[model samples]
Target: MIKNRDIVCIANTTWFGEYTKSTVQLMSRLAKNNRVLFVEYPFTWKDTLTTFLGKQKAPVSRMLGLKSRLELINTENGSKVYNLVPPPVLPVDFIKKDQLFKPFFNLNVALYKIALRKVMKKMEVKDPIVITAYNPFYGLPLIGQLNEALNVYYCYDGIGTRRHGKRIYAIDEAFSKNVDAIVTTSDYINDDKKKFNPKSYVVKNGVDFDTFYADAKNKVHKNEQKIVGYIGSLDHRFDINTVEFAVKNMPDTLYHFTGNLRNQEIKQRLDKFDNVEFFGSVKPNDVPALLATYDVGIIPYLVNDINKNIYPLKINEYMAVGVPVVMTPFADLKDFSGMVSVAENNETFVKTLITELEKDSRSAINKRIEFAKSNSWDIKAEEFGEILNKLLENGND
Candidate 1:
């Protein structure tokens, strides 16, 4: 048995409120028998106005900087959550912010060192097992400070190719080296991590099977012409062209999208398609219910260095709802060939959609449901629990 200790989780923000689907599901399950602490970030892009304005030496930059705090979450399972709060923007954002606004983004790496020292002091707990879902950039400097920390670096997305090039990569690389174990969202990312760390592992993303299955059990009665749908973040990773092709080629079939629109321009561009319906961000709890209305789901990620390696959470979410999914070519999704519709390009996407639409999809639906049942979050959480247990028990360090 793994003894309960102070566990701190780090992500972009605490204000985002709802935890990342995988994080919330895994932690909620882990909290059932252990004391887990989840750290939330309070600072956002807006917080960097001072940094963007090139005012690194400003009082706010110096005083409000590099501080780590904590929050508490009360779960229904009678387990307490220790949420860790960390400073948002580090040295790089400060420089970029300074270029935009005079005296705003003038922060130096030394300030990061100072701020991190303070933040580390606040997060320092006796025998802490830290599970960071993303942002290894932030974790690099703190590794040495965490006296008795068991670091579990969970890479959801590849950091080096995302935005900032060399600097972020260097930081992430250093963090990867210091961590005890690594849990990535996809096998591709695990392969990527092997270049840096020998102990990296892949734990694919999962969904709430029970909720989606319940919705699948009670099929929504709708007279509307529903052919395909997608419910996930509308980030740059999406290939709008493919989505447009799917909607425009099949003018009669209504293409439904449900999620918060991050790109307003893309949303505007998508407006040209009359058959497309945009249902903005739904609460996480309402996903299964909303997915019940869809006939099929689409993963329209562009095949690139950044997106190609991603293991999209929506794939599992859709499958759990027993909805057939069509995906673009991705190395991680190759194993799902027969089970999912794989499109090589925009034209293939449309062709595959039409083919799937024509087929008797009952077997596909059952295959998806059965696949989801075996790969539930409960099982993934247990696997994650075992990893944490081994790390703490061995305490090899």
Candidate 2:
């Protein structure tokens, strides 16, 4: 373990719903030895009040939907420390959400600096370890400005996710240069970071083996009508067309989706298909249970500039639950050629589904389970501790 137990982790996220299992798992692991203080972004309580009121008046309270709740990154060892950051005293909503918000948000950055200074003083943190999960706008600049004893930037997703244009890119570049060391969830980012920071490490995301492992005794039987499922964000990165094709060709198969609908128009378009079932959003704890209920899992991703490189954590989750997965051949899945069924287009996906359905081989399912067992959160946590310990000794020399 790292010598320093008093560490402060600053994240832009306030809501646990916004975070992935890997993100939460990291905090859980760190808290064992570290006095980790998690700082969250400000949320509007008024939103919750408005949502409750709106639900009684209007049919749908879309405008006043309940705000996501902030979580105090919980620990395993029972010793804990955390705080939810209060919203900016300044009226943040007065500014319009547009290109101008970039500069306006910079003001929030200033407020954050003040807030951080005050918080550090209040907590009596002299020289603590500072770790950042997001970059450019939030974590990067905040950690960079703090000048902590040890600074780590964890790049989990692609850099393209934070873009609004050239301005965002500039901010990202400035923030990238300031960090002492970099850790990525994928090897691709580690390879790319070699040009910028030589001290880069790959800490691939893993699953909660206990929670997601196939309950062989309790494994629900696959329905006579095949259930093809996709869980996660229904964002631009997902291939809606591929899913549509799958639904059309395999009319017998029930297309089940469980996640927040990012695009209402896309959702409305999907309404025509009776086979497609959108179960909206479910809690993280409910995901394994949901996956268990499904016959098969799929990552119908739109392979492009954004998704081609980044490794998604969902693949491992699907595998852990022993649900056969079909994915677009992304770089991450390409390595697991035999472990998963790769489909180039809708036609291939449909054909492969039928073939897999007909075959229903136990060997393929076992391979996936074996692969998933090798990559658990416990393993990733150990790897993370090792890296943190090294960083402490090396002192970012």
Candidate 3:
């Protein structure tokens, strides 16, 4: 419904060859009808240094076409994605009461604003709709300066719960109260944001059905034992304890994890288990093939205030592939109880995994595939487009 308008999306994640997140997926869909400027997270001098030192690899030329401060990326969905590159600035993870970092923070903001303004001028975009997805520190402050028609804040997680995210939560609270519209990924987040902005709405995470829904009979690798798998970043949100407990309890089961290992300590701990295999970070196009090999899918997330609100996309991907899914008791998964098995504790998690592995029936697989079809990224994007259209029509009255 939202078409022919220029949209500027300020995302927290990089637009370069990183794993596609919700913002990337939705914005790409939106770009089919509208001109979209997808802004990547600013690259600092330290980041460049790290890349040069072989600590991190830079995105390939095919993925990012750099033109000074601007990088143009061609998306598969025919969306115009422009990545704005900000000048190097100080890195402050935490803010002090004395506001010593205020000066440098403002400088960082100015650099981003200037870079974005140049892109806007080049595109002849005036009064564009600005969508900021969980980047309060950098993006929210630019709302007034950018002369945007409307500002939307998309909250995907309760970031305050993390040790380094306390200050970010403060910014998120302020941003939530001021943004014209607020979109959240879960009910808990929607409720929390609604307290500050009544316009807040929940738009849950969805899967890419076209890619995920392959033949259920397709197998990427043959395994002697049943493969219980997880396909996502192995970050702090993951409950290593639960995975370890399940592995120990079911030694005969083969556990496969295909994603980047963010937590090296947890990776080292999980490596101790002989039954567990970690295939570090597969390509996005190759995910379905990897998933097809899984007999059962698992979401072993830690039970915390932040994670309790997560509407994971992996669950839908697993279901779309006709693989039985067993997840931890996250509140967002409650609605899918019929399709997914939610375990309350480590013991229950292991038991549920075994149960799901045993009960992988054709009828159940068909039902899962159908459910996933209903929640595809295209459908979710259409729904989101309707909301944006309605909001724009009202002119934020």
Top-TM-score candidate index: 3
lDDT of 1 at 104: 34
The lDDT leader among the candidates is: 3
- Per-residue accuracy of model 2 over 1-397 as CA lDDT, tens digit each: 5544667777656425632546567776677776676765543344445446773222122222232212354454354556545443333444445676756667767766776677677767766777776645676557646657888777777676333454555555666677778888877777776667788898888887777773521343556787888889887777878778888888888888778788676577676888988878787777877876666788888877667657778888888877787887656645566777898878998988777666655666666777888888878878887998898887778
Off by over 4 Å in 1: 1-3, 13-20, 42-45, 48-70, 76-79, 86-124, 160-165, 217-224, 361-363, 393-397
Ordered from best to worst TM-score, the candidate numbers read 3, 2, 1
lDDT tens readout by residue for model 1, 1-397: 3555666565533423322467767776777776666654335445566657885322233234343244466753355666544444443443443345323323332343455445546655566666767766556645655554687888877775444445577668888887888888788889888888887776777777776788773342354676588878787877888888777788988888777677776678787788877887777678787776777788888888887678777777788878778888855576565778888888999988877666635666777888888777878877787777776667735
Candidates arranged by lDDT, highest first: 3, 2, 1
Pull out the clashing pairs in model 3. Answer: 259-281
Give me the runs in candidate 2 sitting further than 4 Å from their true place: 18-21, 43-81, 89-103, 161-164, 214-222
TM-score of 2: 0.85
Candidate 3, residues 1-397, lDDT tens digits: the string is 6888888888887764536588888888888888888877776656667776889764423122343666666886766776665555556555564377677778878877877888799989888889998887776688687788888998887766353345767777788888899988888888889999999987888888887886454332345799999988888888888989999999999999878888887778888898988887877888887777888988888887878778887888888888888888756665686888889899999888888777677777788888989988888788888878889899888
Q: What is the C-alpha lDDT of each candidate?
A: 0.68, 0.69, 0.79
TM-score for each candidate, following the candidate numbering: 0.82, 0.85, 0.93
Error of 2 at 170 (Å): 1.6
